[model samples]
Target: MAAPGPVHEALAALPLVDHHCHGAVTADLSAAQFASLLTEGAAWPGVSPFDSPAGVAVRRHCAPLLDLPRHAPPADYVARRAELGWQEVNRRFLTASGAGVFCVDTGYAPYPLTSPAELAAAAGATACEVVRLERIAESVAAGGVTAGGYATAFEAAAEAAVRRPGVVAVKSVAAYRTGFALDPERPAAPEVARAAGRWLARGGRLDDPVLLRHVLWTAVGLGLPLQLHTGFGDADLRLDHADPALLTDWLRRTAGTVPVLLLHCWPYHRQAAYLAAVFEQVYLDVGLALHHTGPARCRAVLEEALEITPFRKLLYSSDAYGVAEFHHLGALCFRQGLAGLLQDRVDADELSLGDALRIADWTGRDNARRLYGPPVSEPARDSGGPPTRKV
Candidate 1:
């Protein structure tokens, strides 16, 4: 495949931005171990903190047993990891990918997921955007779902991160629960279970309309484009519950309200694209940085989303949790995909490279910046090491 035309090479040169990502959990080992417990290949039993791993599981659980191809870890991997940690990753993300701006997350976490102070210090006079959640999980637990009701804690945290100069967008995950349920007593797939994926489990019934109303209204009112986990929530989830079509009611009702940031839209790539076209507020952020999907799907999903929505309405993401490469890979996808897709059309000569660049930049950062906030000049690498992803 000629190495897919060197995605890294093209990405190393593009001016892009990542709109959605959890600031705390981007390390490979920690995340993998956790993921392993949650989703077993054939049947996701979910982590019970007791189950034993098989062959591959043993290797993954016991890192030493892992027979991985050797590549000297990044020159400053450990030290940098210890030093700035995620903040440093963000710093390097801007440095390595030439990304214009990026956003960080801070929701329901005990500690600030993104060090607002550190991010601001790092920005140091650049046109970057920085946004942090003042309150998100609070509202959800408080019997509501609007982004505004989600609570607006310290805008200053966002203000400070951008002090160094990088565009920022307020990052938020959807209201769905990411955890799953398994009936150890009933065997792997519990027949009676509804498995609503992560949110309510398969047992949820039509009576869930009340909860649905709260979530949809909350998201719509907040209006800061929410990144939802549509398909494949937990390993043991009822895949049917994760289907994007089921969210149609939420989509139709919230039509003019909040913008939907479709995360992991791959399993439903075409559906996401059509939604992007149908609902002006809805957008798609094609990703696999989370270890769920791979590169090819990432490329296809974003491409499809772009074909439908004004490229400006779309945004970039990595769903990256563990492994900074998620950041690296996502940037690469946009750069090369843009180049390849544009080259193929042969028609749309009117779609100047500049036009494409504008879309790239918008999809990359500007639009996010405008909708959320300006590019954060600083990123909180100084205030802390990596924020704990335990929750």
Candidate 2:
């Protein structure tokens, strides 16, 4: 690789605020378990995830950090990872990620994963929590709240969850639950009661559309930035329904209520960019997609996402769950992809150097700081290694 340009240098030095992500698995993973986590799909017979883009990316980008050669064989990579143990592996990658603040989603832990504080400690960074609204709602139902009392019980529970110290935001997996094609307006009390009754009786994951809308609207009332999963998730999601464009009416109705962060809009990135351009409260990050696209295609994904997005509306996040390699890979892809795009525009005279540099800082760090407030403690500057060159 050639030397990094000025924009690259600036981005390299900046402390990224990973505005949305999940905890890394603290336990050592077997090769098969690691492979399953690489792709959003299941590990089918006669197929290896290592041949896929994300799997190849781990070998190409993350192998060397484990003291193995770049593009190392899958067996070699997995062996080295186990030899180093999960803690040391996590320390190496999380430190290398250059993230100063991690806003961790404390929901959906099928595995025993690091807590926000543990993740921060491993990286020498600060941490904040993003309460998952659906989890809270589920707990309310599990606690045997009546349908008539579900509305008030859920509201109180959500409010209390956000009030916990270090909680900076809240999120909903509505895309996975019911998608975004529902009525835009908040449900009436009786409507919510009926919906809650049906959901409580069924007693499973919260998927009722009326209840989904109710939780979303309740999030609006909470007045914290809300993150929504938009596109390209596991096999459970219907791709067509995960489009951010489907939230048009909801965005319109909830204008100026709370900042709604659209997460991982890959196939619908163009739509997400449009939403960010038109709605003042809408923001986005192509986090989960970054590592999956890998370094080779990351720039193209970012270019499309930034096509019409207001500079302030684009934020950085890893959305990294399970493997620590994603923490490093997400940051690596983001820095390389974004710097390549902005630097080219500068070279083409389409953007001034100062503006490009400022955009890097805003997208990488400041925008998240402004939204989440300052970290619990100041972020460590040394975690990312030395800058490529001083800004």
Candidate 3:
């Protein structure tokens, strides 16, 4: 049996909730790899994956946008899935989720979503279990295409995620493809801020504002939480849009607006935590830097999250993408990461283990429940296991 990864041991010690993530699909191994990963003497550490998976993990999307090129088409999405060899991604996660995972976040708006009902139906068919749909608006789409193209994608994806069962929230991945450099195609928020008018005055792609407004209206009706992807995104997005500070005004306007989850607190940690502390409708997700940075940086992020954000308002998730290890590692970071943070506790530390545990619990899937919660008619399982068990 292989030894478990450091992150896994940490997770076993610290309870956590995986609040944010996108569950894609995987398929390859003849059988699900759940046993080997979960077995006592398997080669690698932690539970093996269940073969046959789908969905693009978040890590693939994490690298700096400047270094990135284009987003993958649906077909390309599948081609890019990592080969786990014989790893089992799902069953083990299911085990954790069922034990106390909290919840799983299947990506939100399917940018350039094709069909509404069909997409919704398709997700329902998958074992991955779609929890929430992230909706892309013209703000998201406009950054990529003419306003019309953006709107079409947003409308279709929004409709699909809203209607699916087990779905409780709809998130808007509002990052753009174009940066300060402008292009006729692939525009994100930065482009929208400057080009919106001239582009509109000249009839530049039909006003993204109109389309974004439509998206906001449609989602507000759904009554699910809206997750705004913010900070340090790709090359195309304006640094301004990435800041949670900017979002506060947006949040203020929508004060009573449905709840919102702010993912990727990049450049804006303190500000993000302040917002989480101030509004019941707002929460923050910090998952990326957990592994890349040493435990200290991870601890800083966690401490800030607890400073103001109500324990309930705080959420957890791998914010992780890429392969199974990414997911496993991210989940572990949330658990152990908090414990490490607590290790430095002082009057300045300001947070308790109980508070950290609550936040950890939130990270798993609690945010999804706050947003897309399973239907009352559906049988509820903690589904994902608790973050701190010795699976």
Name the top TM-score candidate: 2
Report the C-alpha displacement of residue 257, candidate 2, in angstroms. 1.1
**lDDT score, candidate 2:** 0.90
Candidate 3's residue-wise lDDT over 256-337, tens digit each?
7577778767667667888888876787777655534433356666776666666665666555332343445455445655
Residue-by-residue lDDT tens digits, candidate 2, 132-166? 99999999998889999999999999998988888
Candidate 3's C-alpha runs over 4 A off are: 1-16, 24-157, 177-209, 294-296, 343-372, 375-391
Question: What CA RMSD would you report for each candidate?
Answer: 11.8, 5.2, 12.5
CA-lDDT, candidates in order: 0.43, 0.90, 0.46
Answer with 1 or 2, whichever has the higher lDDT: 2
List TM-scores for all candidates, in order.
Answer: 0.57, 0.95, 0.57
Q: What is the lDDT of residue 190 in candidate 2?
A: 100
Cα-based lDDT at residue 292, candidate 3: 40
